[model samples]
Target: MPFSARLFCRPPRAARSRRSLSTRISAGVTALGLAAVTAPALVLLAPAPQAAALPNGLAATPPMGWNDWNSFGCNVTEQKVKSVADFMVTSGLAAAGYSYVDIDDCWMSGSRDSGGHLVPDPAKFPDGISGTAAYVHSKGLKLGIYESAGTKTCAGYPGSLGHEQADANSFASWGVDLLKYDNCNGDGTSPQQRDTTMRDALARTGRSILYSLCEWGQDNVWTWGAGVGNMWRTTGDINDSFGSMLSIFHANVQLAAYAGPGGWNDPDMLEVGNGGMSFTEDRSEFSLWAEMAAPLIAGNDLPGSSAATLSLLGNRDVIAVDQDSLGKQGTQISSAGGLDVLTKPLANGDRAVVLFNENAGAATISTTAAAVGLPASSGYTLNNLWSHVKTTSSGAISATVPGHGSVMYRVSTGSSTTTGTTHPLVGASSNRCLDAFNNQTAPGTKIEIWDCNGGANQQVTSTASGELRLYGGTQCLDATGGGTSTGTAVELWTCNGGANQQWRLNADGSVTGVQSGLCLDVTGGDQASGNVNGTALELWTCNGGANQQWRLG
Candidate 1:
């Protein structure tokens, strides 16, 4: 999250009249403060409530749909938006529950009308804002608009920096129901000033517009974003590829505590419809986002979506995870090389577990019921979201996850016997070398094996998979596969499930390939504490030395 610049100012006051107005204002403020203090401490102390009512007390989840900026950019037009809207209704997207039709950037002309108001580009939106909004509404969808906090938008168009009121009124008059407010050019001197400006503007609109603050996690927006807007983007702009998506998603795990209720921590829009990534990555992206409680705004040409895209987007069980009434965002409970276990509390008193393989090769991620914070001896009724299959278990749930894929299961208390065998070194362990591995690996690079000492470099975890992850739905790690020869580089690659991803820790503290049987040996047999890049590796004798021993905790 970015920090806002601070602004210092004194309150304006007139000598005599100022004294009277100041006293009244101070009293009102004091009274308000006292009222807040007098309220039940739970109401005040509890993290912000997630269940604030929306307009009309609507009980349904927010409608899902597509936006155009990501793929088409400044090329968005009325015909294009209308076609997408029509497609939403005709392609079964509307019936499947997506309802918002949004226009991103560069749709506006460089000037306002005679009324000193902003105007859409004549060629792009010939019928004007209201006309386009009506056309979208006619398609049984809501209309969404975009603006920047600075003087100019991403495309250098007019922004809402000093004209929040004007823009808010304009949006409301145009029948706009959603606003994607970007942080392009704002004098965000402080958190209070930046948030207050946007909040006050949205409140002034009178009409209940869903304010989406695109501030990219600045100022811990998730903690207080509900007071400012309906949702806030927690990361920078997202790309259409899986690596970018995973990178963004894994980076925001700590921010999960800030998301709930009417406010959410956005990981940016969906990249499902974009064709730059593999099909498995698309599925992983969808699954991870839903698991994280992210807004499901599609960013693609909806009119020409394929069946696979539709199937992925229209998965009801996955969508339910995203729209869980409990509004809790899932967090990373454990991770190891290119694999992760994420858990979220569901509305029905069950828990959703997503076992993700973030490496280039297939990998196994296992966890006992106790390790997942569940009762040791209790059975769990497991329902697979993707396959819609049911299974019963009492001890641990373990599965081999495909590279860049996930296994999503809804687990509830049940009566069943535990029947799974536990890996000798896998129950619960931690590794310090994992940190060294993450800090040293780069994209398209080789995973270098080195001598492990009891120092931070040698400790390994069997509890968590070793996959490095990004917050939200972004991907960042790349495991090219175990090398054919010793000293081959182990580097990070965009997540594509492949054999190169599998890593295992033997009981004697050695890390080996799950597929190749090659051990991860320290380069040059160097037991030196501060090993740097360009370190070479060769097959060496395993002596169960501290340098060779690793523990996963």
Candidate 2:
């Protein structure tokens, strides 16, 4: 069935209470009893908040807990689950809201009950799912189950391919509070079909369950994910290495527009506290996840976490971004080499900007009001989320991030008593640039750095209106007639405002032209400081090389 048509099938409501029929003699007795009953009247009522419609439309934030597949895979057992639950309460994880004890694939046996209901692996979960749910709930936690939308799950277990309603009803009856609906062996050709099938199943369950869609992003799930599930995996499974995490982190920037209240772009799960990455990289990963508004489902053994892991997990300021009511996902405002800057608007009108350095070598990343689409010369207060420090500045904000590290800040409008005069012509001094090298300037003339006199020659503007303009003039330093490729001379052209001339200054110091999608290259490929002007300029690959690195003063 079509997705829209299936969404209209609401769960059937429970039967209403009805008055009982009594014998004729009972009516006479009721008349005499009415006098006795008239002496007093009593009523009973239940005060429930309609299950509090899951936080972020899920059951909780900072989705505390673990997934077995990452560490133990299919070797999970009832004993191990119980031990983990015990440890959760004893190790203070439960208090921190890590309540869901989810069992991934392989917990299913090869058969169903006589009634055609899916059965748990009796050898592993001897007491069945109800017993497990009761045990987990007794510890002040909830139970989660995993299934696939295909004929077989990733671990080759039975999936709900054509049995959406049956599986949904079975889960609802099992007291499953969370469902990790995966896409493993389903028909890849039809995402709409897969989405409709799973959504219909969940909607008919008549129970409020946290639906985590794991279809990756093949079908632009971000656009239609909310109606199908509370959260959808924005990428494939991430490994426990820094490279994997970095790749996944950098990829989600494009999907930021789809994340908001009641829906999230899941970047798989947290690999922190899993003893995989260095302390620095692990912290960076945590901070990045929070800033990106990604779900924080810890995939490690919470019961066995070390002090460092606990500290990283307990950072309230970082958590605030993920739990922010605005639910805005961060997007890459600028990137050069492995360094990038991402920004997300917070509920308090403040913006959370994270400077990330993904390269092996150390690199500096800086951002100004103009680069981030904010007004230049405007005073702002920055509160570093990780360090919990406040910095006051006027004009621009810049920071140097270490290799494979990140610095996150909450920026807001505020008064700064300390104001310094900005350099007039030192656009380079301020880390701002007017034009690329050898950019066409009347053909014969080469692009050269001149004093910031606010003249036509010095003016550089961006495709985004009111953002990233040259220091002085309305004329923007543009790619010479929207030229593309090497030797294309950049020039101070009129702000026809074409996308080719439009540029985005990445947090990592790389400048990208909107139209050509190329980085600004220095002329003659010179990397030495103070390379004289009149050099041939052109576009080149962005490698954080010294030649491509330009500072905005």
Q: Whose TM-score is greatest here?
A: 1
lDDT of each: 0.61, 0.62
Tens-digit lDDT track of model 2 for 229-317? 77777655577788767766755655666666666777777888787786557778888888777777777776666544665675667
The best candidate by lDDT is: 2
Name the regions of candidate 2 deviating beyond 4 angstroms: 1-65, 89-97, 187-189, 369-379, 415-553
CA error at residue 148 for candidate 1, angstroms: 0.7
lDDT of 1: 0.61
TM-score of each: 0.64, 0.62
Specify the poorest-scoring 10-residue window by lDDT in model 2: 3-12
Per-residue C-alpha lDDT of model 1 across residues 412-457, encoded as one tens digit per residue: 7885311121111111011113323433433554434333334332
